[model samples]
Target chain A: MRGIILKDLYDNFCIPKNAAFYIFGALAISIGFFIPSEYYYVLISGVILPLFGCCALKSPTEQEESSSFNKLLITFPNSKAQIVTAKYLLGLGFVILFNFLALLWSMVQVYTHHTIRLTEALRIWGIGISISLLFLAVIYVGFFLLGKRNGTIFFITITCLIAVVWGASSALLGIQTILSCSPGLVICLIFSGAVMIVLSCLVSIGIYSRRYSTGTKNRY
Target chain B: MDYAIQVKNLTKTYKDFTLDNISFDLPCGTVMGLIGENGAGKSTFINALLNITSAQYDQVTILGHDLNTQIKLIKEDIAVIFSDSHYELSFTPLFVGKMLSKVYKNWNQKKYLDYLKRFGLPEKKRLKKFSIGMRVKLEFAAAFSHDPKLLILDEATTGLDPVVRNEILDITREYAKGKDRTVLMSSHIANDLDRIADYIACIHEGKLLFIRAYDELQNNYGIINCSRQFLDTLSPDDIAAYRKEAYNYRVLVSNRQKLKSVFTDVWIENASIEDIILFYTKGEKIR
Candidate 1:
């Protein structure tokens, strides 16, 4: 499992000779977060970070399908169940890592700038993590169940849907309406999000287990 | 005989194809070569053995463990390599080795590094930069480093140069030397199988045509060139397959010694593995 996590991290994230560029980009984003006037722009980075990590989760499956690396995985000392578990766990780890950073960044921006209160920052972080988890579920379902061609289409469609919802809500519902929701509603949202994530994981596991047992090829 | 792999009534079906009731046993400490043409279910058979497909066999035991119930346990002692590299190309050897070291309980880091060095593989370079031949060698190095009890190679040397192919074959031979290790390799290249396989199992159109010792195949199978009139004198039972060419007949006989005694005037030559496969698969049986 450690092997798979390391392999996925390197395979999906490591780009050659571009370390300085990424470092520079990160530094620029960090600086932007500190500037009171650029808080809105820095929020874009917060959303982008988790999505970027989500994209990394997609690569391992895509590479496996294209390269027949599923064969290699079957020969490993671990069972197929373990392999599936590892992928889901790695994805969960990435989501937590990225969202934690986003939460920290959002808190810092809220503290530095008086435009958004602590409750508003908490609302944004809540929505961000929830959306990220839902999107992660969609991505895995797309790759595992729908397969490559359809999976790509599914991923793109869901992403567009998320974008449209966010855009429409910001324009019509307004940030005040979104942030000023009742605490009870927020608790309900948290419970539903948790249920969705758990259900998605169970569904993903079922799909993977079925595929390994009966599938002729790595459809993912 | 203590068997390394045994299958009984193994069957897998698709709407268009079915690997129907295939059965074969490979004794321990020997190489078994699986030969078949394209779409002949060689890959399907291997996949079934590895439990890659959901196809259920009546019975399958590998290295004394049930393939259905104990596949996870069995997998630890077995190593498999395909014709092409299946690893992510962006990963460097060091990273991959590190990952595998944690994955396999018996992974030997020093032995793995030694193999990489021996194969002239750059430790820091990504696999995408390596040639296809180098990629294959890297897989071989990884397979060997773990010291598996069984090696399942599916066309592992297909596209390789002769020298590299020979080197790979030599490594396979060395791996199996006095270690109670077994190898099951599938190939279209008869020459490769002929060099190392103790037993040859031929598949044609998803069916097991024959499974016999390499020595028995070489010693007993014969190709006889005779006239059509003379071919009629031989019994249909003796002729496995025959082809008519103008006035002469090329017949593949099951018993070389019996055919020789029966037709002393005719020329009977030894049948190569390729000839046997071609005749069995492509030639028509005598009516």
Candidate 2:
């Protein structure tokens, strides 16, 4: 499992995807504030940021190993479950790294505005990370289930669900309830992130537990 | 004795196809050739053994590791290669020397360098640019660099020119002579198998058609050529498979020596893997 992650990270972050990510991160910090602070930035981070993370899925170079190696892996003295854990953990590490960067950028936005104080900047950063974490959960599982191609559809579905929740809570009850519920936002965000992570983990583990090989594994 | 691989009643199901039941054993230090027509479940069988499918129903053991557990350690000594062209030299020969050493604990840098130079692969070119033959050699270099005890080749010689194919087969044959390792190769090319495979396993329509020592498999089956009228007397089941030309007929039989005696007047010819596949496959269509 460690070997798998080392290979993926080597292929992804250490080399290929890292350059793009660092450049994207720097660019996001430079240009994210051009639009108003609320929905535009949130949507971009919630949606586009996770797409970069999804592309980081480190599959074997062979895509799928033949039965000889398949048998080799299962009987290799390490649990396939551990293999799953290492991959997920490596993914989580990348998510954390990305999460912190996005959070820092969001805080800078909060600090640039005189309305929110430094402490409020931290609170907003916390909420941003929570939202990104939730997005990661939903997107990662979506990647596992729907695959990389159908991920955009999954994110759009999640977006629709979030819109419905926001609409129902604000429209049915009025914006007064939202103002009153401001203090509880972080908890709510944490709960949402937890649910998405648990849901994605369950689905991903189910896919991994079985010998699930996807894509055109045969080279020719 | 610790076998290189042992499979019993391994089954994998798909929507359109099922690798019905596959069982074979490749003892330590022997190569087993898996031969089947395209989509005949040769790749599927390999996939199942590799635990690639989600509907996991199988009993497979490889490299003294039980398929149900110990997958990682088992993987440590195993290498896999696919036949496309020369394998990608993603990194330079120098870079591969260092990077691969990190993956395969036993990777021998000098041996890898020797293979790269011997194969005439440029250390500087990224594998994406190499010819098919060069790419395969690089894959062979990487695979052997680790000093793997068991090598699983998935159609590694399928589409190469005869010269390149022969070279690849010779490398594997040389690898086998050390008598401490095994290679399981899947190929659509029978001639490649005929030249090197010690054992042969045939799969047809998702079933283990037969697994036999290559010498025995070849020795057992022969073509019994006869006219249409004479074919009427033979039981269809006795005819494993057969083909028909304008005036002559080519039939594949399990006991060719005995069948020749039964049809004493018919001509019998030596059977190759292609003949057996063509005979059975074409015969099934006619029947």
Candidate models: Cα lDDT each: 0.79, 0.66
lDDT, candidate 2, A5-36, per-residue tens? 65556555444444576577658755755664
- Top candidate (DockQ): 1
Candidate 1 residue pairs in backbone clash = A213-B54
Candidate 2, residues B205-228: lDDT per residue as tens digits? Answer: 888877788887687788777787
Instruction: Provide i-RMS per model in Å.
Output: 4.7, 8.8
Would you give me the overall lDDT of model 1?
A: 0.79
The DockQ value obtained for model 1 is 0.46
Q: For this target, which candidate reaches the highest TM-score against the unseen true structure?
A: 1
